[model samples]
Target chain A: MSGSVLYDAPGPRARARNLVLSVVGGLLIVGLVALVAYRLYDKGQFDGAMWDIFNYAGIRENILDGLAATLKVFAMAAALSLVMAVVLCMGRLSDHKPVRWLATGFIELFRSVPLLITIFALWVGIVDAILPVEVNIEPMWALVFGLAIYNSCVQAEVLRAGINAVPTGQREAAYAIGMRKTQVTASILMPQAVRSMMPTIISQLVVTLKDTSLGYIILYPELLQTARLIASNTQVNGDYPYVPTVIVIGTLYIVLCLALSGLANWIERRGRRAKTGIAPTEAKVPEQTGALP
Target chain B: MNVLLDNLDLFREGFVGTVSLTAGSAALAVVLGLIIAGFRVSPVPPLRLFGTVWVTLLRNTPLTLLFLVAFFVVPQVLFPGIDSYLLAVVALGMYTSSYIAEALRSGINTVPLGQAEAARSIGMTFTQTLRIVVLPQATRTALPPLSSFLIALTKNSAIAGAFNNVDLFNIQKVLSNEGYNILVIFIWITIGYLIVTFSISALFRTLERRLEVAR
Candidate 1:
């Protein structure tokens, strides 16, 4: 991770300076930890009972349910958004100006709005107002559609960037062989684009997974929402277990995202090492576009 | 449309809150991000480790979870009397700083190796070389992505609305409960957000053009 070129190898005095800086940095981190620990101890946050709330069968089940709910939304949204991205990407690159304009508008609008607002608006509009009372609309669908719409827009842009990264010569060669524009894009450029940008696409999938937490706002029983319920409803010795609950759930999210990111990196490495007649264009790293894109 | 006019005060309040949240968080993120970027490129091993750890943990975690921690956890364990607004700003700031740092680090990497070597060849120390040469060029390359990260920060402030800050997203919840039409409430919210985000992008584009160097 070191951009070592920025500096020469440390001489004796420079080594001494680095050692001093290291000590100071380490001390700062340790001091912050000690302060937080002292505060927690003063507040009885270290109490065993505070953390024992996880021992309850109902609470464990609720946590599991929340995990399942979050994954359910993520899986559905992931699949739906990918499909929608392709369609939107097609329209975005369409020969028709109107289609391209419509695609661009949809992307910019959704990407600009907050995911929390999109899900909340969708929950209110779709389930509360638009749907007939006879047809029960689950909050889950609202969260899923909201995520799908916002993420699909981002993914479409990523796809467009990827497609643009493809060399012009590949397209011209396709054209010289009498391929139509659609055929050239689909059969030639799109595959290379998708391959070149696989890392970014997966990275965005990680973003989608993280964003499913916004389902909490719409009252969907995702991990964050469930953590709130468990923390608030089940007090431990007259205090809410916010600290323990958050630590546990937040660790779970970190693990899941790290795993997904590891996959993205692995694919990126393998892609780089692959042999091919036409080399994959090195696509620029896509913007980390959400909450958390 | 009339509904927005009727509750114009609420929209105005929300607008102010959103802008304030974005501004506060952006300031914090820039400061923290620059520090982390410094750590990332520094010769110190522990400092680099700290930067990497901070980015990985924060960037991987969802913003909503950070808000949850900021709102629910901070009051209980870290700070006793922090208000929701401050908590929201801190959460958004901390979350966005990771991305900003990553953007800045990549920008640093984009600086040509020969430039650093050339600086060293001329008898410049690491600090002098980095200060006068590397950082300036890196910041230029990093401008576009850094601006995008700031835009993401603006969008992220919407999560604050869910946590009791009176921003545009929260305004929808308030207006809808008042029996206003969802479509109309959303329309206004959308317009407010579009204005903020579009303005940010346009401002950045102008800065990019102004900052353009012959290199």
Candidate 2:
């Protein structure tokens, strides 16, 4: 009888208003969908040839290669970023002030800059300026480095938040037992922080996965870049198939990200039912520090 | 330094462009996010469904992909004559709305049951209870996270720079291509972004502190 937070059950007039409002809202959404369908039809975007371009083996192989490359970069970046985060968070939580400041500054600066710029700069800087005439750096490495740097900063902060979430008494008790600072931090704090913060770290990994699409800007031949190429280079029914290519490629990205998100959710739910004596408080889901794609 | 001084006009244009891009999209995202957050928590099944779909679709896609779609596909097929800048604004804003909605939903979840129950006991309508008792507290709880999203939006605007938007990153491309040092180009552009993002965080922090004091 009383569980709804905002309002009670609707009365007669309220029900009528709600029905009319929903109908209008539903109609508005349906109208939008119809308009999009009509536009696509008129433009011949729904034509068979445009959709059938995927029948080409070469194109499918390109998409698969792109997907593989994307995952490779994600895997490398994910591993490297975790290592970087541990180092940075250790510096951040150190008893020493300068190391803490240095780490904090690094995180803030990189965190504020766009990942696209970082990738582009790395591409140009390494390829054009840094490397010798005979030496070369791959575009894949540029993209990987950028994603790792930016996401590491974010992950480090997430780690810090998790450590902070540990009850202060947990730390004080360790100190009371004459445990050294490093011993308490390593043996006691780090494990609990990582456990409580697993969901957030995985969520940031999703951000890292999506960010690989920025590889397109640097001509890294990732999934989105492959889509751009296929859309621009292919010809079908006198049109470029930009719409179809985007739809297909966008679906791939959505599916991949959703799968990762599903993993995060599973781990989070499992964590909740985890039966530790008195489980450490779960860290808040880290606020997103990067842009939505 | 000379390169920066010589390209001050370009730098200024990019700075202003980023500021406007951020301001426009922030306005749109905040408004749309609030509406979607309403849909998410409303006592109607359809609205809740709609909100979930919107968040999932937007959140799962890449911003660069959205830029490609918004800049290339939509203008070509859906709205033949739409301005590129306008397209960028719409895309960026729409992408951001998902995060904002998520932030606000979490905020709403944090509101005490007693607060809402007390409002209902006073015979407040849903809209009134929400607008008065719920949203203010929600916004308070949501402000810290919301600020991070806005700063991320600023950096994300850099992506728009490559998409025909004359933002800070655009200046980076221009100056770097002009045979200037890449390091110098990055330094200046980075400073410009730091200014905008730092100002945003500061503004949000002050606003949050003000709200705290009032409470």
Candidate 3:
């Protein structure tokens, strides 16, 4: 990439102009870093001594519990949402107008509304009212459900697009073989659609994973909330020890997202190796040769 | 019911604050996003890395945490005397900017190489080609996703209420807890948010259709 860029080397005037922009850009980035650093120093944000507390049995136990709860909720949510996404996609693509309309409305409503609002509403209203017995619908459940609802909508759209993008001839051939609409959709369409839409599905699931942290606001005792509690309770110098906690939690999140990205890249490369469909270059450009004999 | 009805003026004020916060943050986010998007696409290695790291951090972390950190933690720690509302705006603006930046960068990537090559063949500078040819096309490509980001940003601003800010959702929560009609309070809040999100989505749909035709 560097070789190609240098090969198309800029003229002197262009180089000078780019140099000016580069300086300004560098200054801006440095200024942002300085601002964060200044804030940390002035606020005494790094007062937490997590290293010392790391040996404490109680705090360690809580961390383990929190990690379990986080994973449990995330797994349940992702599984539920993927199932919901398939149903919703089918509904949206159905020949029946009512089904399509209902699917569309659901998708629009959940996707438009904030996840926080949905969680709060469901926790306060429906779950609290109907299943107040034998069902402890904690904020954790609310967060997971809310995430599932929103991400399912997004996943549904992705699936619908992928289904549509499949070659029209596949459907025609299936029909000619006397396959019904449902049969065609199940046997032919869904498999191809799933393959094509896997990347977007993984992308939305990564979103779901990150959104698990939102449960902290409603006191879900997720990883983020654990960090916050630990930071507040532990004192190294002074104040609430927010900066170090944030840094720790933020770093954890970065690692998770990068891991997901790596997985996505791997899957994408595998897909390329599989060569599922016609390559773009293989798409013949039509030409008129004056009604070629 | 009557208490809630009578306190409609207070609700309206809160609604205004919510609207203003959404509008202000969206505008700020767009400007910040464009700058970051430019940085990510720039030739400079460190600048590109900065853009990537910024997006990665902001994108992965919860927006609610960012808001709380800005309002409750940051001020208490850094600028001890600063107000929560300004902090909320700054946090939300920065939070939303990261997603918008990603959208715009993807949009820029989708612009055909031929368009820039055509622009430069006539002796246009790289900057000139980008400004005159690339950005306009990228903007059109970005409009749909940008619209969705705006919706997300608006909805997330409800977290301001969590931080004791005088926003619509917070006001409703207060009203509901004060022996006012809880249903009415929530109903109004839902309706208010619905209008904001749906209308913006609708407007964007129209713009998208127009851009499709124009392209």
Candidate 4:
């Protein structure tokens, strides 16, 4: 509140000034929206006929198919990435020096490269070269592997941070109990790490969902690709339905991502409520610094 | 590789385009983000609501969709002369700004309440207090995340290639089409991105150290 210590409560003059400023700001925003609306209207982007293309069964089915493909790729990538994350995290955290270096190199290399290039490389390079001539590598496979590789590195970092966050005392205690290294990691470290890093992990999953759109570049019939095809192919009143198609697609993406985050929030709440195993010791972990979507 | 040497000019142009896209979008994103951050922390409920909505909508949608809208839909409706490169910049800027705003807001929160209180007691206006007292400190905390976001933006800018923007990724595509090894082409593009991203990371590290000393 303005009455908080951050600022003094407004006097009459200050109150009037605040009102004027707010009104001006409000008008500027409204004017900007009106300007965009007017331009769209002038271009016939707001025509009902353009939007009405979605009513067609073929277009609707195409969109649904695209959504399914996108979801399928996302599901595979999400599962593979989590498995890959665990493997990489363990490798990175390995006691052996060569293993640690290999894991670090892999994570850093993939993490630095753009996800699009990774997908492209897998599609054009690895899939072509490694796979037998008889075996067909679908764009879906390329997209899933590409996403899994890149996101596994990211998730590895998140999991590593969470693993490192587990109390040293817990590790010491586990060692004192004569547990093997793998046993300590699997039982003592990983469960607590996953619990602590659940929010960040889920957020990364949201990112993976968003990144699925990149599959469209590799000729994958994902949601964005389908939307583009629809918009380009369909015409209403002699104008392409680019505006309406984009709106629908973008809205779908927004809805899907929001739903994912909402689920994450629910899981986090449930995790907080369940009083199960050993509570993680409170430690101030340094914030992980990286480009997170 | 001989392919890279023979096509130096193509690579140069692509590299330049990628740099321009990254720099232009980063600049626009920072400015837009600052304004949105202002809206977020403003005392007015409506402004706060507007900022929240902007971040929510933009952040949830993928950058590729935004690019499609900007390149295909926006230019058709609003700016006819705008090219794909410019549309890419706009789309990248708009999408990245949401993250920037969130980072700046977090930075702003780290500025102690007493700082604002003291500034206000000294008769400084809210704008003056923010500009002089709050944002300076906020910038220090925000720099690392801002740079990371910019790095991410550089990578995300590759999506422009799909829309006919001849960035580094596009060059890789072209080179591959010309019978060059696809793996080699990808490695080159990957190196270009690494150079850009690492340079950003290094620059921010230096800036952070200098700010630490200043503080």
Best by DockQ: 1
| Better model by DockQ: candidate 1 vs candidate 3 | 1
Which DockQ value does candidate 4 get? 0.55
For candidate 1, write residues B82-143 as lDDT tens digits: 88888988898999899889888888888999999899889788788888989889889999
Regions of model 3 farther than 4 Å from truth: A1-8, A11-24, A47-51, A55-57, A128-136, A278-293, B1-7, B176-186, B205-215
Q: Number of clashing pairs, model 2?
A: 2
Per-model chain B TM-scores are: 0.96, 0.98, 0.92, 0.96
DockQ values per model: 0.62, 0.58, 0.34, 0.55
User: Over the stretch A18-121, how does candidate 2's per-residue lDDT look in tens digits?
Assistant: 78878888888778889999998899999988999899999999999989999999999999999999999999888899999899888877887888888878
lDDT tens per residue, model 3, A1-293: 22111113567876786688778878987898899788777665543353556568987777777768777878999999989999999999989999999998888667666666667665554444445464566687777888788778777877787799889999999999999999999999888878866766676677777778777767889887887788778776555666666666667676776677566656666776775562111111011111101
- Give the lowest summed-lDDT range of ten residues in model 3 chain A: A283-292
Across residues B133-184, which tens digit of lDDT does each residue of candidate 2 receive? 9999999999989998998899898899888789998888888878887767
Candidate 2 ranges beyond 4 A from true positions: A1-3, A126-135, A168-183, A277-285, A288-293, B213-215
Candidate 3: pairs in clash: A43-B77
Model 4 CA lDDT for position A83: 100
Select the stronger candidate by TM-score from 1 and 2. Answer: 1
Tens-digit lDDT track of model 3 for B1-215: 56547888877888887888888888899999998887777666567778888887887677766875786577766777886778878888999899899888778778887776777677776567668888889999889778878877778888877778788777866765665544456656777777777777777788988778444
**With candidate 3 superimposed using the best TM-score fit, by how many Å does residue B29's alpha carbon deviate from the native?**
0.7
The true-versus-predicted C-alpha distance at residue A230 of model 4, in Å, is 1.3
Candidate 1: tens digits of C-alpha lDDT, residues A11-97: 899899999999999889889879988887778777988888788899999999999989988999999999999999999999899
Candidate with top lDDT is: 2
Clash pairs detected, candidate 2? A293-B62, A293-B63
